[model samples]
Target: MKFSTAAIMAFPAALLLAWQAAAAPGQGPDAETRAWWTITEALSNDRMEGRDTGSAGYDRAAQLVADKFKAAGLKPLGDKGSWFQPVAMNEIAIERAGIGVGDRPLVFLQDITVDPSNAMPVTVDAPLAYRGYCGAAALGDVRGKIVICHGVNRPGLPGAAERIAAVKAAGGIGLATIADPGFAIEPPRWPFAYARSVTLANASPDTDGFLRLRLKADALKKAIGDHGPDAGDLIAKGSAGEPLPGFDIRESFHATFTVKRRQITSSNVIGLLPGSDPASTDQAIVLSAHLDGYGFGTPVNGDGLYNGTLDDAAYVALLIRVAEQRRGKGYRRPVIFAAFTGEEKGLLGSTWFVAHPTLPRTSIAANINLDQLRPIFPLDLLTVHALDDTSLGDDVRAVANGMNIAVQHDPEPARNLLRRSDQWPFLQAGIPATAFVFGYRPGTESERIYRQWYRTGYHTPLDDPHQHIDWKAAADFNRFFKTLVERVADQEAAPAWKAGSSLRPAGH
Candidate 1:
């Protein structure tokens, strides 16, 4: 049951509708879920080619969204009064690379991965230093070495930025952070399709000759063979965030890289549904989801396309469903629908949009972002990011409660998921915002399914339409999203930040 772009594009309208309706009896999606699945299937089918930013496939998906918006009676609210806002970006990818420690060669994207940067050297042979956690105090005399640090994400542990700065301050040439295996809430994923980076076109690229690398946890021992402290003990202590002594490894590091760079132009799809009331019409409530994915990448289990069905294609479809349900009606406040690009490239699309909004920036009242919302299992509980930072949390909690769904604040804040999506950009701009994840108690079947998805499907070729889905859960969340939107849009006052929240920006 695979579909290709050419075959789908060649089908007549009636034939296509018939094909869509030919699902097996009793196995078909529920009526409530059918429309949502239809849109998702269209966007995520093989023809779209994973919808990578600035690619032809992304353009096709964007056009489909724009057509849907027009049919739903939404007005163009993008740049130059069109349904598209062009975003210029610079894309960099590692065309080829190899790394080794002493005589042991490490497999690229398997044993280790290098973060692509223009500043990375084509070849390097430097001494290695093991600085536990790479904390400032532990980074002593790492000058000209490739520093190794434990990648711990919990509080009190020096995070990536802190470790990188400390290494640079100690005159280190590169840093390799071992992927922590102890973080069970969200474990590190391996075999990245490729190493790439996309940044705003006008932004300055990293010019310093400092390399960033992520070594697979299991590879740490092999990388340090008989050179320093017992690798097993170091991993155990580092995973626990326990202090360990820093030492220079006797092994030297060597690597060569072939990098490619290109200029790309991706667009954000924007549409507006005006408000019924004149007074509140100026203040818009934004609904957003990223439309970019990894596109074609290194093959996994013989599949190369990263369809991104649940990662975000499904939610983008959910947005279209919302617009269709409105059917030309306006809420009390204007609603802006934003289908963003370059989210996988570090939230570049949303960041650009926030900096250069089509409408006045001050007119944005709030943002209800849709990303990382996996309803693969039952929709019994939801983990809400920024749940306590703004009144938007209250709105969502009330809505979920009325629907018999439990809502909890992000239980694993150390994942920093709160700042990983489009919502964070809105939050940074002083607009109330939040996102969600389907929650499960530890040791539940739902938890297993969630973790399995993260391990096999997340950012992989397995994230396609063929994957198992809880249709009932999907419908339940769709209803919840629509209800929450109406409740916030029709409310008299705009959502506000809660007092004493650290996330709150100055001046309201």
Candidate 2:
């Protein structure tokens, strides 16, 4: 069959429209559902290239989000009458990496993972010291030496990052940490060559070190060779919450790394829906979701695009649906919809937004952010992050109860999800904030589905829109989200921090 260029170009949209129409009798999902589907399909399309921050694909996704905001009657709340608030960053990629001891070459991505931010050809040949959990006393004689450390031994112990900083301050030349069992290296998601690292240009350090890498446990053990406790023994003790005494390991590690750095700009897409009530219009509610995902990288299953269908594309779609549904409506306070960029790169966009807010900083009342909430199963339970930290938890419970859905606190605190998403920036700025994840009790079918999704697709190219999702569950959450926003916006006063709440930053 022969087809014209126009016909080929029109196929996807026409097919999607047909699917929408076929789902109903000559009418499709109401405007809200159609709105959600259209935005999700457009953003997740292969052509968008997974919306990696600072890439052309990310620019296209940002534009799409801005257009949706404009079409939904949202007031542009970005810089100088623009929908884009520019964020400056530096992108770093590893060009060369190798580690060796004596004449033995330790494999990359197997025996070790290097810090790509290290200056090219970072030749480090230094003495080695084993600093267990890096207490102030443990950091002795770190000058000009490579420091090996156990990962966190308990929740309150100094973590790997903290230990690295201390070692660097004490003049350590290199840092390597044993993989924390769940670190990115052991199961190796992408190949070693696919390094796409980014850091904020404003926060760039004046000096760089052979920062840190994940050293394979067995490989480290072989290197120590009875000079110190075995790597596996240290890890087992750390994993079991036991502390170990610091000692010197009799070995010197050598490594060289090459990296390429480039300055780039990405943006956060912000829009505002002004409230109807004169009294409350001064304060606003913010809804946020990230628009960036891992772009093209080392191919997995011969696919390199990390199309974040659920990781964020879905929730960004939800934000659009809510904005479209609430246009010209009667909420008492304004609502700000922010599609953040560089979330995968340490919540850069939201951090920048909070630091340089378009609105008066104190006037922003609360933030309800969304990241990846897999709706693969029914929507019977919702897990609210930082639920006990502020009054926003009460609001979530009230809204979920009205919808007949049970609300729960973060069930897995060890994941430290509370401090991981875009919402954390708002909370840090002393604004009441929280985020949601679909909840599942242990050993249930819902738990099974959630775990399987995480194990298989969480950050991979496999998270594309072609994967399974319960559309009805999405619609249900959309309804619940809309009601929550409306109620919070219409409340008599701005959401408040509970007295004595640990999250209430000093003088907030």
Candidate 3:
């Protein structure tokens, strides 16, 4: 049909609209993040692309935190007693990584790639010995040889002190897993690729060479056995076992890598509650929580943004409430409230803050750290990390007893979650700290009404206020912490780290 000038203009607009619709799913504003996000609205919006350490977004976030501290009436820890405490850091990303078996070049990610959890860069020219699994037996001197291990072995193998004799005897340089190598074969017969994950937690290779691989255990077993014990070896020594011919490494090779590392500056936003007593003000109790998240690429349904609402946003809000409550009550000792950044990046903000404090770091008494506190109900039990070594434990027991709440150690120690939050900074700096979280796992007896609300909304973009949270439960926890902090702040006694802890840093 012949169209008029008006119709012609509409066509371009219509095409543009269609293009937008087509790209909607994969490309759009991060809706889920926008929903669950509770970061400072100003900062999260202005720097929503993510506050990457080196990006302008980070600066915006810095300002928001500083403003919060200022509004809260806390003294600044910056150079001239300002709010910021700077830290140095360096960020790096992997450019290229490959493996080699003799002259065959191993493919990337699918075939073999180093795990960054416990990442290191290096070059090697040596034969490989598949140690089967990197259990305790895989230890020892693996000075110049490649030692093959399963992904599970990198964490300490049970009884590892004795088991790694083989690695020690052979002088191996590193140990790794080759479970599923870089790619896969489909019916059409082309290979597809997938990357591997690694961590320093389980990566216990004695030598410096660090890497991870994807492989089928039983299949690799047959191939290595058939080709001699060196069949699937990436570094080329003879791997023993039946060589499974159809199983292909596709690619495996190694080259020298120049690792660049650096430390960049970061900060912590803090406010305070001046005590009624001058002496007591010097000895303070810390109230803190991490103020950071996955930043981006965080899964919020289809949105790649991490809205850390219950992840600690709620805790931040609670902290504000507690501060408001204490402001009404006239504290006897200083109450230091810190909203720390760099928690997702490795607890750098708190670490730096404790190193350079606003008041006498030595006088600082204890820390009450709030995290992932989307309470579904008044928790019947309370969780504590590092509770064994300090007077804070006594305080917790007393307070929990008073509230009739069972005080328990971290139920999920496997996650190492106790040491995983912002509190670890204060703990490492000689302050006793406690972090609180609540949830009922699959098939549990918790009939608490808030359980259902917590189930679906914990970490997603849906964790907005609408996600059924027991505000009453949140209130109870707030009251519990407020009472706990009030008692500590009023007490003249100092809260200290348990003796024998490797964590107590000097001058803390």
Candidate 4:
């Protein structure tokens, strides 16, 4: 979802001209481009209804991809000889929540936004300890206290989840985080009508239950009395990325949360192209992309549907194109094409797939996940997630180099993108995995366009097929991705984690 721009300008003038020439509409694209467009356009069409996870729209989209897999002669690798691996999910919608300090009641979403994570019901009344930013230095005496943290977390430091994990480890009863308005990627501090959590009905809670919320500055200021550094000052300082100190707020906070739950199931479309070589046939190269989008959300530009055309549907189309192009042919290792559901919902589908694989867990050799390939600009560079963690990174570089596209490491690690996508589960399971985003160097038109897409179209109705797409760039990327798959599948050795990789499993 980010880029680097100066590397783009380094391309030769003739290369730019050729790229422009290839993008012209009347020139007509070849079969791969046409196929990719046809599938992407169809998936993003109104008929698909944004393909929200666990919705009928998503079911229809899954069937559509399954039909394509069938047509391409890919064998079903899903449940009960069908083309879908069903995943059970529990949807939790917050009904109501409240917070209070002394006589002042903090209004929901306006005065604060609470975390909807429901391991068990949450109710807490505890003394507040103002733990500045949740940094190590600020966490000294938070045991059994309600810790107040400024901002989600410091940049280049632990994220909200990680900080909360530390808090739980420190025996904190609850946490309240102040949001920073300065970060462009931060979502608005609006009330969430509902939230989702994995339905691990049989498992015990991972940690002791706690109250977590993001408090508005005004509300916190009122709650803390006429305190040192009013809420506004604290928020402003946090916004400017300044360090804060811990102190006892000398107030008791009360919170209560409630949620309703319903069980739902989503399906991941799984198909496999069998390997020809006996030695490698048992191993599988998994190609993945999410098949779900926002579905319906707060309306954007007068439209409610978040048709994820380039955010994914396009990459799913690329998967189908690979199936088509590889028809009547075979790789050395089996190639598994998986269009996962619930990527927009905490990578649920892929997580389920890894936990309950259609094939043996040991058979998965590697994962190459695709998502949000913005071809609005030229495809001069590619960003490979986890670029330094596995040999799959080397494979990606070789493929990109062969296609004359520069390969770049992720430019925005703060996004935590490597752990955000479907590839993450595979990596966590000790499989070498990677995901890609189109790259642009800093200070280029490519960077501007890329930023513009995220700001305006990302998760919005503007992401529909009607949006402009550099078809030639799409074609180029599809080709490069297809070759990358081929190279991985044909390689003599299965993909491997690099030594000293933090993601590497013990003794791997």
Candidate 5:
């Protein structure tokens, strides 16, 4: 269904006016912030159904953004000169699964979660081994065994990929990683809405048949009852990144799985704001935010919709606001506004965009991605990812310092957050990029608010518009973003990879 510009603007315009009227003379969000919220509310309201990738809800949201882009006087830069680049995807989910140790069964999604795969075996009854961190040295001759390892998300510790490779090479059929309890910055959240994975439709499924699973720290005792080292002691050692004993469980592990698979199509909404200066028109600055959310999921407090207000709806709205603000006059460098899909699934959309950009890949100057940002507290500081990798960091620091906002490199690198968002794909492609998080000092009220939001609102229904917001913080970040973009887009030199940066491609 197509919507006229008038029809599309009608609802949001009314919402903006209502929000403005309700604002106390001087007590609420500023006018610009109110406008930003109006767009956010329109995209994140229950009516949009959380904008799940490839769903009608997402399509509706995409069309709305395209309409806004058209009204903003931006030129469509998607496939076939339209405002969207269609991306084909394959989604897989676990319908039901059971995992057990001896006669004890672990709860699905509560005690354990498995990665869904088309190549998953129907049943496996194999000897179990506790291989500590599953490092190559600890993994003994475990032919046809399921290995359990401590899941540590920090540098210098064996991570998931390395552990999986070691186990697979050692002929292990499965791996269960015990969730780390010591990572206080971002502790694990349980009862995940569901276990789902999405990949580009053209990508081949893994045929290796190795099972991947995550075990709750509290459930470790039950899973290894009377078979291996004491669960409590092992967890303590692993959490502290200490060496641990590797031993075989006396009892065999059993598992059965049922998976559902389907193919779907989603799109990235793209628009081009042509540079006013013809000399710099070929160099485009890409501004991006993901539009996909969890959609409906296992109910938390009887509300299943993951509205994703700040997880990204708010940032997408911010992109639209930027387009609207510069409708008639674009920056010196062309700006590509991309509302990407399938970020929640795994950065699929941006990956696709980088591989198949609407414009020449060489012309993309830099990307300033907006995700993983929360304005629940004052924006006293900003944590910039890739802060040392490229000149973009210098641009951010200059703009932020003017606003009295301290800029710092990622404080929590163990989270592996730098590789977790849309900006990652661009960086991998040798395009200088950066993303941000509102920073806080340790043990402060600001830190408490930031942590609390991740605990309750990060990916849950609690991320809706009704949640408390720091109006000043929201407005301040918006201003900072606007200024940063102008500075980067108007600057004479294109962003460059810093010397000695590992991410810089040859000749870049």
Candidate 6:
């Protein structure tokens, strides 16, 4: 698969000037700095366990945020007349299970992590065929075949599934996604899965004829090779050629898991900054960031909370700041400041929010989502993803150009960061949305910083509120954000998608 290099365009000199620019009339986020830190600290405190959506801990966090909004004198746009916008949700936490090739069992949690997806009558005698990542073309056929692919494949092979897909396109079916899945989200890689069943699955889906391979190390290495720089560092994937040893048990490889499905409740904390104009109040610009994190993974500083400090904890703070700014401005359009939950569980929070919207969907002009941000990135430039087909992309570009920061589109399409964040729900609803993430690696030092973050901090209990932030960078970003919103909000017309653009709202 071809990869798009991340576009890192520099800002015009004027953008740099804005950092030190005179307040153009009114050019600063309201002086709610204390409020910013309080919200950030509270939601990310060790007690919350990373605020896993639907958890009691997250409920407490939500109540606190709503209280803060109420204290700020903001109103709820929700139907029920309260600032708290309840986002209905279904939460599933797969207990544990066992999978084995023979009498010898494959490691669980270590060598594999399976999603108790669905139940199949414990059948005996399954066949063999290992599919590739890209599917068929590079891998081979695997229909009614027991396939063995890597958890993470590497070099000299297109990856069994990629080959399998190629073959599938040429006519192939019944595939499985295997990879050495990890549980950390520090530097934030892929989610750990015994099998990558679907691009995105809803609730308890089928799991018969489908299986994710979590193989034994010896077999794994032969299948995937050492995961070194030479492995899949730059290109290729986990999957290689290995004939299935004519090994078959008269009965099927029986696997049992204590999978329980439960309906969980989480929320989207929404507060409205109603605009001065009643006509526009019905429509609004939404600011969103997920508030959930992988709670209870590794311990951080003796604290057990998966406090999503930077993942979205920071963005949540930013959302409040924006709300404060809009309320103060006596703005002309309703601005929805939403804190989403269940992002770690597949954008569930945002999905729930959109599906059970407090306001009409058509009135939602656009969404500005903040997933993760760091101080090191040059604050002078504004980086956004999913720029294609939206006028907002141009609005951002124009503002970036006017501000002098070069705008950029995502270089990596395969990653599909667009569909991955909270922005997708609105995007799917036909309203245009975009997200901002802080990412740029100039050299080894930067790489080291991100690496250490992933290994030692991300998704761990260690992700705490104690770490100091680059206050200046935070201020600068909020400044740019202020400008971006002012530009969008002040416009006499709502931002539109370019014709034939994939992002255009339905019936546009």
lDDT of 2: 0.77
Please provide, for model 4 over 296-342, each residue's C-alpha lDDT reduced to its tens digit, 9 standing for 90 to 100: 66454356677888878988998998898777478999999999998
**Angstrom error at residue 347, model 1:** 0.7
Model 4 misses residue 226 by how many Å? 8.3
Query: Model 2: which residue pairs collide?
Result: none
Error of 2 at 271 (Å): 1.1
TM-score of 5: 0.91
lDDT tens readout by residue for model 3, 151-261: 332233322333344455556545445442221110011011112221122224444333433444333443244455444453222122212222222223344444444
lDDT of 6 by residue, 227-268 (tens): 222323212333233322212123234455555556666777
Off by over 4 Å in 1: 1-28, 242-245
True-structure lDDT of candidate 1 = 0.88
Cα RMSDs of all predictions?
Answer: 6.9, 8.3, 11.9, 6.4, 8.1, 8.8
lDDT scores in order: 0.88, 0.77, 0.53, 0.77, 0.87, 0.58
Model 2, C-alpha of 354: deviation from truth (Å): 1.2
Q: Per-residue lDDT for 86-159 in model 5, tens only?
A: 99999888878888899989988889988877687868899988889899888989989989999987678788
TM-scores for the candidates: 0.92, 0.83, 0.65, 0.81, 0.91, 0.75
lDDT of 2 at 71: 89
lDDT of 3 at 148: 61
User: What TM-score does candidate 6 reach?
Assistant: 0.75
Model 2 over residues 141-217: C-alpha lDDT tens digits?
Answer: 88887777766535777776688778888888777776554432112233332555677778856356456766666
The list of candidate 3 runs beyond 4 A from truth reads 1-55, 95-119, 122-129, 136-148, 151-156, 159-170, 177-263, 298-302, 325-330, 372-378, 439-472, 496-508
The candidate maximizing lDDT is 1
- For this target, which candidate reaches the highest TM-score against the unseen true structure? 1
**How do the residues 1-508 of candidate 1 rate in per-residue lDDT, one tens digit apiece?**
8566457546543344345336312355687699899899899999999999999999999999999999999999999999999999998898888889999989999889988887788898999988889999888898899999999987888998999999999899999999998886777877778899889998987787789999998888878988678999999898988888888878899999888999999999999999999999767999999998889988876788999988799999999999998998999999999999999999999999999999999899999999998767789999998889988899998999999999998888788899999999999988999889999998886786677567666898878887777777888899999999999999998888999999888987
Error of 4 at 201 (Å): 5.2
